[model samples]
Target: MKLLKVMLSAFIFYLSFIYGASAMAQDLSQQNKQLLANFANEVFVKKDLTNLQEYLHDDYIQHNPIVPQGLSGFKQFFADWFKAVPDWQYRLEKIVAEGDTVWAYGVYSGTQQGDWLGIPSTGKHYSIHAVDIFRIENGKLAEHWDVIDTYGLFKQLGVIQ
Candidate 1:
């Protein structure tokens, strides 16, 4: 048997070069999960943080403990939560990425007349339930993890209970 047909054609050319390098690493992990969901839809639903180092990652790690770790404390905690909710909105039901991480499950409504985290003006609406996770390396957005609901946004601003 001609050397067993050259060892079964070198094991079928090494299994098609390992499935073509795992399908080119799954298309570069789905383009890094659509570039982190289009950079989280341009900074959380187009609030437009504008090119912050072309999508963060200048030591951007923050775990969201009242957010203050890097990237100017994540752009001053979303610039004081979008200047106390200047119609701030985020909806994302679910999103996920692989090898560089990227996860989201969202709903973040807003309409605060003024202060927050110090809790003051709850002039109108509120909606919480947010979850965020990001990692991404070479393409930026280095590290972040968040979970918002802050006790259902302080019980929908009734200040609690």
Candidate 2:
């Protein structure tokens, strides 16, 4: 009777452990999705990198279509881009996440206020669509892949002509 009771207790504990692990995994996935949404709506649109630093790993790598960069490199790149497009804002269209990966689709619009990529500012408003895929690990962004409408931006800025 003692052995049977002990075995029964062990089985119950094993089931509880499995359920707890599953719940933890689900919670992590939900947290990652929420983090991505906040990143798009708050950080990217508002250009508020201060708060974003918490979620971004120090070794973050960006695979931008035009230029690849690490975390510090992206910081400088955004700084320069914002300098050129002072009124720049991003609107999130869609966001999806699974496991440790999140994908965001958005549109960036702004008026040229300073030089960018050697193109003189024309003070003209431009809109470009963009997409970013991010990988998060241990609750921090580890890497990113980005695509932007570079041709449209250049055309609007009169740099492609």
Candidate 3:
């Protein structure tokens, strides 16, 4: 009857609406995953900080105890570290994305050529595993929380044991 037809039409519309919303969320998740991968490839591997504003928000927040907050702070910290170890490299091992958040795990390798962590360099190479979680907002990185294996880095550098 007419009522059955109208009910079926409404059910179909509801199904389509649910699927559309799910598809949009999936698109956002995929886009964020690709963005984070490119960030690792560009910033971490290539060491290109030329267009920071394109990737990071002006008020970027950092949660690492050693690194200061804000985009300028992040840039300055990395710049100093890079200068101390000109041959630094980051190798991404894994990346995970969910909604506006992305998590990355990687190993950072570098040879010390100058002072690091207030300790004099011995010109030795070291590798440290690190994990970072980033929050994306409006297509830009807005916040970051990271954990680096500082003890491993220090021991590898012969600072301890």
Candidate 4:
């Protein structure tokens, strides 16, 4: 009957729309995963900031208490740490990306030769674990959060008993 054919057509269109949306979401997630990996490598491993604008938004927001908000703040924070820990580097244990958020688990290692967190140089090496969360927007990092083992780092630095 005409009614049965019309109903079938509508159902098919609905199914196609749902499938298309799901496929698009999956593609975005995959792209986000790659973006985070590249950003981490360029920023943390390579310690290069010349191309930071390609990975981070100008109005990026930071949830970490120690670091201020915005891209300039991020660059300054890294500049200070890079000076304090000349050999600083991060080794990622795992990374997960879904929707517009990415989660990274990694260990940071370096030797302190300059002041950090107002603590004088200890001339000692330290390795600390941390988890970073990022929100991606328009192919750039828009917001960030982190949970670091500051206590362990301080203890290793001989700043705590």
Provide backbone clash counts, one per model: 0, 0, 0, 0
In the predicted model 4, the residue pairs found to clash are none
Report, for every candidate in turn, its global Cα lDDT versus the true structure. Answer: 0.82, 0.83, 0.89, 0.94
State in Å the error of residue 150, model 1: 23
Global Cα lDDT for candidate 3: 0.89
lDDT of 2 by residue, 1-161 (tens): 99999999999999999999999878877898898887776667778777657778777887764444666766777778888888999889987777888888899999999988677778989999988899998878899987888899888877777
Poorly placed runs, candidate 1 (over 4 Å) = 7-13, 23-56, 59-70, 73-75, 82-92, 98-105, 115-122, 126-135, 138-140, 143-161
Model 1: per-residue Cα lDDT at residue 1: 100
The stretch of ten residues in a row with the least summed lDDT in candidate 3 is 65-74
| TM-scores, each model vs. reference | 0.36, 0.79, 0.91, 0.91
TM-score order of candidates, best first?
4, 3, 2, 1
- In TM-score terms, candidate 4 sits at 0.91
Ranking by lDDT: 4, 3, 2, 1
The candidate 2 region of ten consecutive residues with least summed lDDT is 65-74
lDDT (Cα, 0-100) at 70 in candidate 2: 63
The best candidate in terms of lDDT: 4
Ten contiguous residues minimizing lDDT sum, candidate 4: 89-98
Clash total of candidate 4: 0
Tell me the deviation in Å of residue 45 in model 1.
16
Task: Estimate, for each residue in 39-119, the C-alpha lDDT of model 3 and write its tens digit.
Answer: 878887888878788888999988887787777888888888888899999999988888899989999999999987688
Which TM-score value belongs to model 1? 0.36
